[model samples]
Target: MKSRSPLVNRITIVVCAVVLTSIVSMATTLAVSKSIEGNATAINLAGALRMGAFRLLAQAAGPGDNHNTAEPNISSFLDKYEASLFDRLITRAIPRTADHPLTNQYRAITSYWETTLRPGLENHPQGSPVSVEMHANTETYVDSVNQLVSMLERRTEARIGLLHLIQIISLAFSILIIVALFVDLRNRVLKPLRKLVSIAGAVGEQDFSQKANMTGSDELAQLGSAFDQMSSELALTYYELEERARSKTEELEKSHAALQLLHTASRNLFANHDLCSGAVPMLQELEELLGIGPIRLYLHDKEAAEPVEVVTTASTDRPFYCRDHHCNACLVSPEDYDELPIEDNDGRRLLLPIRTPGKLLGTLEVWYPAETGLSDTARRLLEILSDQLATAIFLERQITEEQQLTLAEERTVIARELHDSLAQSLSYLKMQVARLRRLNIEGDQKSAHESILEELSTGLNSAYRQLRELLATFRLKLDTPDLATAMRKTIEEFSTRLGKPVGLNYNLPPQALSPNEEIHTLQIIREGLANAVKHADATEVIVEILFESPQVKAKIRDNGKGLPVGEQPVNHYGLVIMQDRARTLGGQIVVKNRDSGGVEVILTFVPKSRHLIPTEAPST
Candidate 1:
């Protein structure tokens, strides 16, 4: 459809109106000017005729003897006046209605000139009486001409006022038309443009609801339509972008939450040394973090032939017990299993196998709502948590085994001590008592019997003393797991018992020994202290434990009478035991008589591995 532009149409109408007003104004002005010109012309013609009649009269009355010439001049002036009057009357330059007397006077003048004055002038000479009468008529004619001229001047002034009035009306009309045009333009163009500008600003501010509702077929209307379309599209795109941003933000939050969950689970697992107790909090954390329910943990029990339920965040009604590894999800390795939640008879469940580098320890199982199963982040977090759990379990088991082994070794040491020292003494005592009884049965003499009884009593006392020492050795316990603390306690105990100040110089890092190593080391120190107190007759004792690169050296020295002269060191059971302990520690023991006075027992050993010293102390 070819629609006319409203702006163009409005402008065209305005132009036409202005042009029409201008034409009317021009025509009125021209008409006024023509009227004025005609009035002026008529006034001049009347004046000229009046002047000519006066001149003619003057020439006739001048006393000149040329009356024929004056008569000719009067005839010529009469003819000129008649022609001017005819022209003025014919052209109607002077309105007959308002100027009726003037017109009548002009007509009478012309009649008198043609009929009376002209004939008289033509017949008589200029000096005659008829000429004098003509001169009087000329003066009346001049007065009428002046009245006509004043009338014409008044008419011209009236025409000029009418022209001005018309021009004022035209100008007012033109101004009205122009004001209308301006209003039309303002309504049609400027107003809509301002509205469009406002809408554009609103769009820039991301407020797309505002619209340019201009209702016309003008260019501005088209622009508004295009703007509306653009706003709609921009709003749609903005909504899409907002949705995408929201989704991304949600995803990022989820990822951060998952990472936090993983971090917390890892910290819990590694923080607590007790696997069974530690796993509970980690499982609870996982449950809360993942928004799942009834999280359960299982540990493999080789003896039971089934995985044992170790910890649970919820009730134990839904235990995941798999003995034969029949459940695919439970037995699958972390790498082999896909991280998707599995659907079984008991709702959706995610199974993550807790594993270490050596073996799979168990499975961490969580039951979730079917509609909102596990997300990938949760699954991955569970996987990481499972690995940490497995590591914790492994460490706990290894520590337990080490403790058990240490206990067994202690038992062995006790058994060896009993066998080596107390057993021999008891056996000797039993032999002596039996001999004394036999001697008594034979009715030996009193002196011999008393002597044998004395020997048996001495052997029994030695046996009792050895048994007491064995008991004390077995009763020794480390106050703390660190070797240095235990050794200090031992030194303090011995010093108090011996009623002598026992000096100790300890300079080894804590946890420098395995449990078993610490047990052996403590036992050797105990025996050395006992030997020093009982046999060395030492007044002061100094115990020193020092570490050199890859080797630990311990020494017990006393200010006592040196070992008996010519005594073999290996002959002493206590020295032998210390040597055995040192050998067991992959080291050697030296018992030397110090030049000062006392005997010094020194042991030096290199650990099997430098890495045996734990970076962190073991929790009790």
Candidate 2:
């Protein structure tokens, strides 16, 4: 295995390069500056030496008679010049060689001072002629020293130019190094980091297809590898979770479909009051839901002592026979047949017992292919269907019985009404005819004969009126479900039959009366209207039905001659019947003459059954 340099090392290298370059640049600058400073010192020393030599020469060349006075000044100038020259040579560290131009000049000047000028100046007195030679030599030495100073100045200028060049080069190199570092950082660190950021953002959005294709022996590469692993694991986990959710959803859908099928079948079975009308559709629904067809339903006819096939899906010529034991098997122990389907030649049959709480109504037989047996779910659904069918059948039978009982009760009422009104009236007429025949044979008084005839006529008229009232009561029909509409019809019938205006002010709440209450109320109103038309001979009649909580009131008023001023007609059969109806409704009826000069019949009742009270008023 091979190891590469880490990011830190690479960065360190770049920093070190910058620092090293800076150090080198500074060193070069210091070297150049020191060299220029040394050259400046040399130039200054040389100039001083030249100035001292000129002074010595000038003093030496003074008037010959003043040579004694100028001697000390010339000696002082020589000493100063020697000191400046020695200082320049020592400071410059230049050898006395002729290899370099400035060095050779300096060495020549030093040799001239040491070997000739110094020897002459020291050997000859200041006032002697030898001093003249000394002045000339000093002037030449000053000129040479000036020439050396010029050369040193030129050298210092060249060194300054070299320093400027080095500084410029160093600056350019530093800039290039910085640019390289920036480019390297962008390529190696910033770009890859940006890619990682983008990848992370993609991962957050649940898109895992993209990968960090970063390549290096760096930490970012290792991080990318870890990220890829995490993404792969997360994707795999998500796939597994999705598959589980899909499977669970499928299971839930299946359960819901079964429940819906059962619910629909139950609704269809109970929706129809007559089970025979709904049984075919229910069987078809069951066949569809169970994925099997050819269903037959057999209901036991206890009166006929046989099983009747009420509904069947299959068209077969062969009749289905129910044996004694088969009916008993369903009725006695339903659980025995719940485990498995019964095998048959055409297919398998599942015999489910249709039973109510205590009675076995019938058996439901479902036929399926032999290869496909009944599933537990199918069996369970079949049991539920059978239960619903049993319930529907039970309700149907109960409703049929109730209808028959209501018809019987109505017949008994009609018989009683005939016996009470028509039978008694006819018996009276027969007796009157017998008496009239006897009186005619005996040849009685004319007044007595007229009275008998008049009585007969009145009796005949009253009997005819009672008969008409009975016919009207029997003819009354409810065209709509609303009690208000029924009341209006009753009022209209009376108005039309009596040839009198009948007005109905109906303000009762809908559904406030049960079927029994409605019937009794209608009859009572009919009786009241009949009395108004027959006895009152009213010109106008008004019927009012008012509803209050827990009680209903009906009022009938006629604008006719008030009741006779005598005992009430308590024994009148019509009035007695009206009172009976009111008693049956747990209420009472009152008949009185209005104070304003008419007859008024009022009936008030608290409904017998609270459960039968309707929530809203009947629609007219």
Candidate 3:
């Protein structure tokens, strides 16, 4: 947690070591270089001294006039030579030992130059030819100068070698320091950093158990400690979250299973005949779902407003829920939702209302041991089961009521059919008989009586035919409950009987129309087919039932001679009966002659999804 960085200090130390090594190398080099600084100049001056000796020799050998031009040149050159010999570059390069080779040679050269060469050049006669002795002295001086130049070069070369040695040592020291710094960084920083990187990678992969585990008080150690703490915290938090998630997962799984079981129960309830038939198995499933005790179901008639039936689990040998007179259901209306807090020698009893929207139809009573208590989950499940039970019972009752209403409506239609066709024929026959009786009484019972009798016979036969048609129409209900199946069979039968191709184009969804709508629609098609069979005298027939949303349309076409223009079929009430059925279904039918020489019977109606209940808003 400190803001201290040891790496900075370590780098500072390394830099200082390198800089110090460089400074020492430079100082050593500077000393050695100072020792050899002017050796090159000294070597050049020594060579020049040798050349001056040659000039002095040449001057001594020349004629008197040549000496006149060269006397001042030799004197000036000798004077400069003396001054340069004792200058800093030459004199300051003195060796420590008095007998050192370079120093001795330097002194010899200086003495020779001052003692022999200078005097020879200065004191010689002007313009005199140089003697052989003077030339020999000059040669000796040139030799000394060459030896001095060689010694100066050797001395300068030695100092240069020392300077190189210092530089080499400085480079080695710097290299050593840099290598040490790298090793230190590897041990102190780089290794730890690599470990931290690996740990960070592990953490990214949800492996929070990995730790940097670095020791010491360096920056990396502190970073590692902080990282480890973070990892620990993350581990704890993740573990807690995992526990909670696991628990929640268990709850969700249980809820899913319960919902699946409840769904299966509901499917069995509705898929079977009625609630009473499947009630025992449903109650047992509810018991298994809740882990509770025996359950009972009571049925109530909303119309009669009394408890009508009781169905319970087969587990109990006796009447567990109630005795006939001890039942508390009398205290509550069939539509009441109040709880029946009935407890008996059996145990605690819980009652769930089996109800639909705005109506209570029955109750599901569960009796459990007194020690066993229901959880909120189980109680909620029971409520849902009760709702499903209510829905199934309510739907079944609705189907029964619809079938009864349909039956009554059809019976009324049949009565109207009898009145319109068969009853009219019977009345006509009665009149004919009365006329026949009058003829017999008047003793004119010859051809007139026979005609009246023939008329009566025709009326009776017509009545009998109408009666048969009515029986056939009624028999359709017992034969095939499904309208499509009945229509298919009818089409096949008519094709077989008429010896003509009969096509059925049924395009309606099965659930689009109610049972009543289907019945009326199928019967209208049958009536059209019947009329065609009796009188159409045609070749082909086509029956089509189609649905456009909110509407069902049926068409029965026969390639048969249509009815006489504006006239009904004689002694037949098919059209009247079809009109009655269509009216009952809140639809219309048209029976007319096709333009292509046939009868076309088309009926269209809005199908009822429910029993014509007047709702405030239409359900989508």
Best by TM-score: 1
What's each prediction's TM-score?
Answer: 0.45, 0.40, 0.38
Name the Cα RMSD for model 3. Answer: 22.4
Q: Which stretches of candidate 3 lie over 4 Å from their true place?
A: 1-445, 478-481, 610-620
What value does the lDDT take at residue 554 in candidate 1?
Answer: 88
Which candidate model has the greater lDDT, 1 or 2?
2
lDDT (0-100) at residue 405 of candidate 3? 63
Report clash pairs, candidate 2.
Answer: 509-617, 509-618, 510-616, 510-617, 510-618, 511-614
Cα TM-score of candidate 3: 0.38
Residue 108's lDDT in candidate 2: 87
Clashing pairs in 1: 67-126
lDDT per residue as tens, model 1, 1-620:
98678767778888998999999999989978876776766777766766766666665555544445544555565576567667844346755564576556556666666776556555556555544566666666667667767766777788989998999999899889988878887888788889889999999899999988667777888898999999999999999999989966875676687677667666766776534445555565556556665667787644334565656654312222211112122233444223333344335877888888878878888777687666776677677777777777778667755784677667768867787876787777777677767654446477787786777676576556656666676766654435755666787889888998899877654334666787788888888898888887888999888765447788999988878777664324667778889999999999888988899999888765332221221121
Mind sharing the TM-score for model 2?
0.40
Error of 3 at 511 (Å): 2.2
